[model samples]
Target: MKHIKRFIALFFIAAVLSGCKEDMVTVSYPEYTKAFRNPMKGFREYFGPGEDKIRAEYPYPYGSMTKEYMQWNMIEDDSSDGIDKIIAYSNHRWKGVEDINMKVILRVLLVWVEPWHGGKAKDPNNPDDLNGWHWPKGISPQVSPYKQIPGSVGAYVDPKDKTTPIIGGYFDPAFPERVAKLVEKIGQAWDNDPRVAYVEMGIIGEWGEHHDPDLSTYWPPHDEPEHVANRTWVPGMEKVLGDAFTKAFKNKKVMVRYAYEFKDYEFGIYWDSWSQPQEQVRGYEEMKKLGDRWKTQPIGGEITWNWGDLAKFKSFEQVVADKHTREYTIEQIRNLHCNHLGGITWANFNDPEFRKNAEILQKAMGYRFILSDFTYPSEIKNEKPLNISFKVVNTGSSPFYYNWPVEVSLLDAKTHQKVWSKTLDNVNISDWMPGDDWTIEKEAYQKPAPINEIKSSISIDKSLPDGEYIIALSVLDPAGMLPSLRFANENYFEGGYHPMGYIGVNKKPGKAMIDKSLFYDIQSDKTLRYNLNNN
Candidate 1:
C-alpha cells in the first residue's frame, strides 16, 4: 500500500512538470536560479535609507568631472605647486586621480610681446615686478596692462632672438613639440594623474588677440603675403602638432580644440559654432583628417549664443532654463563623435541653470554614478536547503544598468564547513526610475533555471550532525562580464529586472504547495520545513 501511494505522488509530480512548459508563455522570465530544497518566500520590505549596500556592491573606481572648469575655477593659481592640490582633490573623490581614467589632450600657446615690454615690463607700483626685464616702448602692445603677465598662465616663453621683428608686437610662434613636452612633464609629476593616462600634446597659436584682429598689427597686412612678416596656422600646423602628440603620448589617443575661425580664410570654410548643421558635418570631415588631434568645439565670446540666449544672462541660473539650447548643444556634441566631451566653465555649478545643462549633458554622455542602494541577506535558516531574496535600485537621477550578480553559499555556523552554493547571472536592470521596486523568491530543492522555483534540498543522513548554520548571499558584477543591458541609458523590460516581481523561490515541501501560492495564499503550512532525521 505504501509503495502504491509513493508511485501516485511521483506520477503527479511528473504531470505538473509537463504542464509548466505551456504556462511558460503566460509567465515570461529571462532566467532562473538552479534548483535547491524548500526555498522560502518572505514579506516584501522597503529598502532602508542610505547608500551603504550600493556602495559595497558596486564601488566606482573613477568619476567624471570638467577639467577646464576645475582648473579655471578651483585652481586660483596655475602655478606648478598650485596644481598639486587639484590633483589631491581628484584623488580623494575618485580613489585616485588616475583612477578617473579618461582620454584627454593638452594644448599650450607661446606668445612674444617684445616691442611693448621695455619700461612697461615692470609693474609700476611693485617696482621689482619684472625683476628689471625691459624692451622698447613704442613697438609694445598699445593695450595698457597688456605687458603685465596674463593671470591665466600655463607655459610662456621669451623668443630666442629679442631683436626679431614682432608682428603687432605679439610674435606668438607655434611651439607644437615644445608644448607637448611641457604637458607630458606636468602630467608625470602628478601622484595619480588621469590626463596623463590619455593626454595628447598640441598647441593652437591664435597669434592675434582673443577674437579681435586689431590687437595684432601683423595679420591685416599679411593678405599680400610679403606685406606682413608673420602668419598663424602655418600650412603644416596640423601635422606638426599631430607628430608631437604621438611622440608624447605614445600609444594613447589624441583630441584637438576648435579655435580657428573658418571665416578667416577666403577659400577655406569654418563654422561660426558647432551648431551650424552644414558646417558641423564638414568640420568633422576636416577634423578627422587631422587624425588624433585634441578637438574642442568653440563656445565663442563670454558664451556662445546658439547654445542659448544670453540676453538675460544676468546669472548662470537664467542660462540653464532654456531646454532647447541645452539639447541642441548635446546634439552637436554627438555629431562630433565627442561622447566623452568637456570644456565648459559654467559661471555657476549648482544653480538650476547649470544643473539643467549638466543633466542633459550627463544623460547624453553616460557618466557612471556612485552606487546608491544594495543589499545581500545576512543569513537564511532551513535544514540543508534555504531560500532568499535581493534588491537593487538607482537612487540618484543618474541611471543604473550594470551587472549585480547573486551568489548563495551554505556554511556550517559552528565548524564553518562548506556545504553547497548556487550562482545566478548578474541581475541587470534596464530601468530603475527615481522610485521603483522589485521582488523575487524560489524553492530550494529544484535545479536553478529561468523557471526554477527551488534552489536545492539537504537530505538528513545518519552520519551527519546538524544544528544552526549560515547561508551567505553576495552581489557582484563578476569580473570580465558586461551586464546584458549594454547601452548607457536604455530601458529594457522583457528579459531584465523590472519594477514588478517576476522570479520567485518556493519554500513549500511539495510541488502542490509550490503552485498553490500562485492562486491562493496558504501562508501557514506553505512555509519551508526541515527534519532532523530522514526526508
Candidate 2:
C-alpha cells in the first residue's frame, strides 16, 4: 500500500513539470499588441484648437486676421498638445502658418464691406512700399485703419472719401483692378504653401462674404442711393475676382461663397448657409450639379445658427439676427456633405454629452483613415527590397486633397534610430476617398465601397548593418520635410509617424557584423582620467 501511494505522488509531480510554457512569440500572438485605429477626424477651429479635435483641453481664443494683424510669431502655447489649424484672412501674404506647422484655409479679403478704391489695372506697389505689413521688424510705419464688425462698413457714409483709409465695396469700378493686384501679391506669398489648405476668393461683400449686402441685409440697414449702387454687381465684377483668385492660388484649393456667382471659374464652394436649405441664398443646385466635386476639392463652411434650429435662418439676414445658435447633428452634418464645420462654440462643447456629439461630427468631418490590413514578412534578407502590402480607407465624407509623401523607415530595434528610409512614389492618397453616407434608419452610415490597396515597396541599402530593426511609416511635408500627418492607427510615434510593425535586420541583429579590432579600440578610451576632470 505504501509503494502504490508513493507512485501516485511521483506521477502527479511529473505531470505538473511537463506543463511549463515558453515565452517565444508565435504567429498568432505577435510580439506587438494589436491596437485598433481611432476614427476621429479633426474640426477646423478658427478661435483655437478645440477639445473635440485633439481629444483634450480647448485652446484659448484668438481672433481672425486683419491688415493690422497680418504676421507675427505665434503666441507661445501655455498648454500642452498645441494648435493644429486656422482659417485666416489673407492680407495679400502668407503669415507664419508653416512655422507652427499648422494647416490653413486662406481667405483673400480683397474687398471688405466699405468701398472699392481701385480696379484690376492698378499697378503693383513700388518695392520700397512693400513692407509686408506692420512687421515688428521695423518695416514701413503705414498702419491699416480697417475696423472690426458692427461698424466694419456702416461707419463709412461717404463713397468718395479715401482719406480716412476705409475698406472696399464690391461695385467700386476700380475694385477689380485693386483686387487683381492684391491677388497677384497673394499668389506671390502663399499660393503654393503646403500649409494653405483652401483659399476663399472672399473679395466681395462684408468680410469677403461674397454677397452684395443691400438695404434688406446690410446691418444698421441703409438704402442710400450711393450705398445701393456701391453694392451692386457689375457685368464682369465676379469674373475679375473669381478669375484673379483662381490664377493667384494656382496650386491651392480656391473657394467661392456663392456657387453661381463665380460660375466662370473652376473653384470649390465654402457654403455659409449651414443647416439651412442650401439653396435659400445660393450654392445648393449649382454645387449639386458638380457631382463628386468633393473628391478633388473641399466643400466646407460655418453653420449660420444652432444646428437644432435648422429652419430658423434660411437666409443670410436671419443667420445674422438669430439670438442663439446650436451644434449640428451627424445627420445634419452629413446632409450638406461638409468637410469641416465652423462658427460653432468650441468652449461650450467640452461637456461629456456635447463631446459625445462632437465625436460623431469629428468622425464625419474631413478624412478619417483606417489601416484595414497590412502584410509583410517577419523575416527579410539584408540588401533585399522590403515590400509592405497595406490598405487604407478614408472613412470620412471628403478626400485628403494633398498628394503628401509616403515613406517607410527601418529603425534600430533597441534605439529606434533610422537604419534605412525610402518613399513610396506611386501611392496616390488623394484618390482614396471613402465617402461617408448616412443610413438614417440604421443609425449608421455605409462607408465607401472600395478600400484602397497599396502594395508599396522600398529597397534596403546594403550599407546598413543587419540586425533586428523595427519598421515604421510616415507621410512627410516636402517643405518642412517632417512627418506632417498622423496615420489612423493607434500606434503613433513622437512626430506624427506610425509604427507598421517589426523587421529583422541581418539574421542576428546587434550581433551580426563587427571586426574584433573595433572591440580592442574601445579599451584605450578608459585612459582619460585627466581629460574627464574639469578641463
Residue 360, model 2: lDDT of 50
Report lDDT (CA) for all predictions: 0.29, 0.50
lDDT of 1 at 214: 22
Q: After superposition, how far is residue 527 of candidate 1 from its true place, in Å?
A: 40
lDDT of 2 at 319: 41
Error of 2 at 301 (Å): 0.9
Compute the lDDT of residue 70 as modeled in candidate 1. Answer: 20
> For model 1, what is the error of residue 274's alpha carbon versus the real structure, in angstroms, after optimal superposition?
4.6
Runs of candidate 1 with Cα error greater than 4 angstroms are: 1-63, 68-202, 206-230, 234-237, 258-317, 340-354, 366-535
Give lDDT: candidate 2, residue 476. 66
Per-residue lDDT over 1-535 for candidate 1, one digit per residue giving the tens place of the 0 to 100 score = 9999999999999999885422210112222111111110000011111211223311111112222212211211232334465456434323322221222222222222222232223345542122222222222332222232355322122444222243432333323333344445434433123233222122232311221112123233211222222332243444544444444443333334333322221111112234333444434445444322222221111123333234444543444456664555554433332333332332344355464455544443321221211222222223423333433322222222222344444444434344554555434332332221111122111221121122223322222232433333333223212111211111112111111112112221111111212221111111122121112
lDDT score, candidate 2: 0.50
| Residue lDDT tens for model 2, 91-159 | 123344343344567553322233322112212343112112211211122222323235333333343
